[model samples]
Target: MLYYATTGALPIPSGKPQYQQPSYYTSGDSTYSVSPPEDLDASVSSASGVASYGNSYSVTTSYAGSSQGEYDSTGSASGVDLNEYMQERFAATFDPLPLDKCTAKQAQTSGHLNAKHRELLELQAKAQARLAKTRARFAQGLEDAREVRNDLEWTQKKVASLKAKASKKHSKEYTKARERYPSPDMY
Candidate 1:
């Protein structure tokens, strides 16, 4: 009553500051501190031309048929044959070996011993098998590389689509999303 009479307000008790959970982001063994959405501004943005948190975030809507034409879909099983490109690129230095043929010349002479003929044929067969296996492995590596390239391309397209959707001008949701957010140029 006295405090209220003198200051025209009741006495207020001070309490300890409440503990807050720190916000951060993780990316492949790295961590970054994140500010509150309202506190975000020019500082949080990345200068490497890549989108970071804060100004980078906005209302992102899915656009239909976004994935279509992101990559070539020829409807054929063979799409963007990397092997053809590789052959053209490296054909000069790394030429494919000719298949080794097993002939009578490789076998024993003077009434051709049966054991020697069998041994010669077996060696030839083994050599051919090794060559075939190596070729198959090379083909598999090329396929794996192609898959990685496609996946990267798809991811990039998806990110780009999201950025475009978020930054689109004549949209109700975009305006609403920017209610408390800063200018789109910050993004």
Candidate 2:
């Protein structure tokens, strides 16, 4: 939250939760009680008359004695409580696997082939790498096939035109070209 401080050099400490006394230094001759904002809101909301301050305006907040901000968090539970709850949930979520691996078996009892497990894991990793490489090569092969197919079709059309042109002429070069470019029946 951004605080708009209207006074000289206010202390908004983040290092700790508790504070001894968050006192206000007034240059005038008035001092205000350190009441919680919600409490003041409640009081002001239920008021029959308006209250006024002369020189300095005060909106006070307090948490009982040294345990400041203990019950003053955004919600009913504080940050520390929330962190502990999350840690417990994390531990509970993953604490009960089968303990099949060597390190996990070592953590429990010692009755598993640790070396074979490691070897199998290494083999699985190698197999996965090979599979990924094969897929990439397969995609490249498809791209190359597309280019090859387009070139083949274009070359076939050009040769077909040449074959037709060669049949219309009786020159030696045209005869050689007509024979050099075989007809589709040859395939």
Worst 10 residues of 1 by lDDT: 1-10
Clashing pairs in 2: none
Q: Candidate 2 residues 8-101, lDDT tens each?
A: 5434344443223345435367654332222222123211134422222233334346333243223221233444676799888865556456
Give the TM-scores of the predictions, in the order they appear: 0.26, 0.33
Best by TM-score: 2
Return the TM-score for candidate 2, rounded to 2 decimals. Answer: 0.33
Score candidate 2 by lDDT.
0.53
| Segments in model 2 whose C-alpha atoms lie over 4 Å from true places | 1-112, 171-187
Model 1 residue-pair collision total: 0
Worst 10 residues of 2 by lDDT: 39-48
